[model samples]
Target: MSDKIPEGNRSARERLAQQRERDKGREKRRRTLIVSSAVVGVLALAAVVGLIAANVGKDGDDTASGPAITPSGATGEASLTLPVGASDAPSTLTIWEDFRCPVCAQFENAFRDTITELVEAGQLKVDYHLATIIDGNLGGKGSLRAANAAACAQDVGKFAPYHDVLFRNQPPEPDDAFAKNSRLIELAGEVKGLDTPEFRSCVEEGTHDSWVQKSDTAFREGGFQGTPTALLNGESIFPKKGDEQISVENLKKWVLEANKGKKPGTATPSAAPAS
Candidate 1:
């Protein structure tokens, strides 16, 4: 017998080996495709969930029932709130901000004390317009939920204190911790009577969801540039004259200038919550 197989037999053996290799490669590619498709599906689901959560109160269709917010000194259908201050203050200070905005946090941290003093002294009427721009940007319900919760606090006359506490405990931008109703209720505990069953129910039911939507619409309609937008007597002072950065000193100066030649009324405590 010849050591080598006949030519025809040899050719058959080679073909068998080649076929095996091709089959192996095909199976490997098939597995890779399956895994890749699975990963893509998972990612797609996560993206969808994030979008839905972020858009919770964006459509202005909230029909949750709770105690209605009584508007004593509100504008825009109570979407804009008046902090505890003199009703007829000489200057009107309006701030458009998103709770999840780091820049808004910076603005709040820098001017919170001064702003409180002015409001307490009956020199300025602070009108706060909560916007949800960050939620739209970051794809989470935090901004929307937080704004709604703040409005809920306003319902019980604790808007000013509760507003400060929110900034004080604001989660890092993009974190959805503030979006949780439980977390919002926890923060409300800082304000007396603010964590009541009514408030909790209001927050959970998203009573102010429609109002938050209205506020966002107002912000867009105002034709303003961005969050932490500060206006003095309806004049833009945030980017003062040359876009100069604002500091505590300059902020006060601008306010005083707005009040110049105008007499300030006796400071009356506006709707402050009891401590």
Candidate 2:
């Protein structure tokens, strides 16, 4: 029976190959998609001799309510929202993170939405300071590539989506999964209305690496020397992350305490929860 089916079956297998090509073509047309690599280093861009906003809407952007943030952490209120689009939250919290660091991703996963709400409300501004601490001083090419990809995504107004993609697909070290710029472009294509070609070009040449560069300069000049370091209104905030991870409640209290005229350039003391 097997011998009898041989010629026809062999013919059917060859036809299947043709069908795959047709299917692939149809899928490409049905959905136009592209992604680009995002680098996460600053020094490399400068070493390579590379040099480098806009207003967001109310409703679709932010899901939470808050007040405007000022240079002052002196706001007497617990909550703050922006006057128009930026938050009036009274402080800026900068996070110096490495994409490869699982802890950094954890903190971001738990806080990005809340932080976005604050940024949209103009109550807070969170700047992601990319560093190679996770990848060593060289930080690997992947770090630089991913960081650059992030900058391009930020360009053409696709920062938030690209940001999520980075955290969602953070590479474990500079592995092959990360070396390919195709992966980044693939992720960028997932973002609606994102210009893949422009983004791809930006990432390929490491255009967005400038942000990473400037951030690194700031981190060093500002005297920060640790991973996952948090800075609030220029004051360092040290949160005790344990079995009970940092929550909005804890963040709220930290902000309140930081605002209460605490020591200059230091985190507000965290009090133990009452039983």
Candidate 3:
């Protein structure tokens, strides 16, 4: 018998070897493709995460560029306060609030009449410190823009009425209505003599934006929990005072107690434009 294999058998062996080599090459190429795809996927995911982080940081930041243009008649620390009522009033009510906050609107609406009465009677003065907590939390510019508009109102001695109007016409928490200068100007129409060209210019230009941002930064750094932070004569009064829950009557009582034997304020604040 011959030792050599038959031609047909040899040809079959050669074909099997070629097929095995092709299979190995295919497997190697598939593995390389999978690894490349995985790397690309990871890189894309990382880019998305970085973008999200940047936007989140921007949304939460309260700092602003340019000079902090203190609004007219602003007082107290860093001139971040917008004063309402007599400067010499015996009792001072300090309020930190956000225009877009529903709770803040509720607070203002519930106590608006009482506050107005107290302010008119010279028994109490309010120092409003505006914040953009809603903008930071809910992702909108309404709080900041509305605050700037209110500061514009302050420039024209219309802050109190305009502030009331803004609260009265506040949109839902999710609605960024006040972000539009047109909406802010429209609301200003509710207040007498608040919609002048200068006022419009101020609102449109965001004249006091830097100031509002500074105020927001102060609120963040001030360690307060949230908006509508109310203090009476340097004491916390919102939601509670001592063992008493806050109510209109309780608020009045607290103010009366604090003003006991104290003279009401008589110094009238000038509404001159800030130089």
Candidate 4:
């Protein structure tokens, strides 16, 4: 017998080897595709869960349980307004704001000085309406907690200074730093006489949580576009008023115009103490 295999047998052996190699490659590719698909499915599922969590309680389903503890000095409908400046000032600036809202922080930082000037001059009194829209929209309690802390400040007549401190030191939107009572209390130390045991207790206990929720409900029902809704003398003046864009000069002009013949307010009495 010849030592070498026949040529037809050799050809069959080579084809069999090549087919085995091809099958191995196909199996490898099939396994890779299955792993990729599973990873993609998991990521998509996580994204959906995150979205649902973010939107939790936004549908008016999560009402805060307990009596709504209205903050001291809160006026307006349903006791939702936190008034600053002289009560009888010639012009009234109504503002709807959320502590966790970046836009609200921006508005406050930009207009804080001007508003303070007008308020001191007795030309403008501001009605601040608090809302927790960020908590409902972004899945955090910063808005509610911060608003409650501010309300605590109101209890002691320190709302104005504490409000400024909060806006000046506002954290990034997603950080949720204000959600922590300790953080809120720490920030309170910046405001003179605001870091008291009572204030700390109010913040830690969420004394005004229900009130904050009610205010947010009012905002939702108010049909306004979003947070930092600024109205001067019952007319919206943020971003624009009538045909002119809002600027520092425009704001001064608007307040002056509104108070053209009106007398500046005298010193208004302090808010009645909480019962």
User: Which candidate leads the pack in TM-score?
Assistant: 4
- Give candidate 3 regions above 4 Å deviation: 1-64
Q: Give the higher-lDDT candidate: 3 or 4.
A: 4
Q: For model 4, how does the per-residue alpha-carbon lDDT over 1-275 read when each residue is reduced to its tens digit? A: 77999899999999999999999999999998787566445433433443343345565325468999999888899999999988889999999888877777767866799999999999999999987877777777888899999999999888889999999999987898998999999999999878878888999898888998898889877877666788998898765688876667789999999899999988785865642
What's the lDDT for residue 210 in model 3? 91
Q: Which residue pairs in candidate 4 have backbone atoms (N, alpha carbon, C) closer than 3 angstroms, thus clashing?
A: none
TM-score comparison, 3 vs 4, better candidate:
4
Tens digit of lDDT per residue, candidate 1, span 49-136?
4334344434432333454443334554443654556768898888887787766776677679998888776778787888887776
Global lDDT of each candidate: 0.72, 0.50, 0.82, 0.82
Give Cα distance to truth, residue 194, candidate 4, Å: 0.9
Candidate achieving higher lDDT, 1 or 4 = 4
Residue 266 in candidate 2 has what lDDT?
29
* TM-score, cand. 3: 0.77
Q: After superposition, how far is residue 90 of candidate 4 from its true place, in Å?
A: 1.0
Best by lDDT: 4
How would the candidate models be sorted by lDDT, starting from the highest? 4, 3, 1, 2
Candidate 1 has a TM-score of 0.70
Tens digits of lDDT, candidate 2, 1-275: 45465888879987999999999998886554221111122222221221110011101111112332121121122211111123334567866665555556656666677766655544455555555444343234555456557656555545557767777877654353544677878877778866556667766666545445444444445555455666667665433333322455556665556446532222322221211
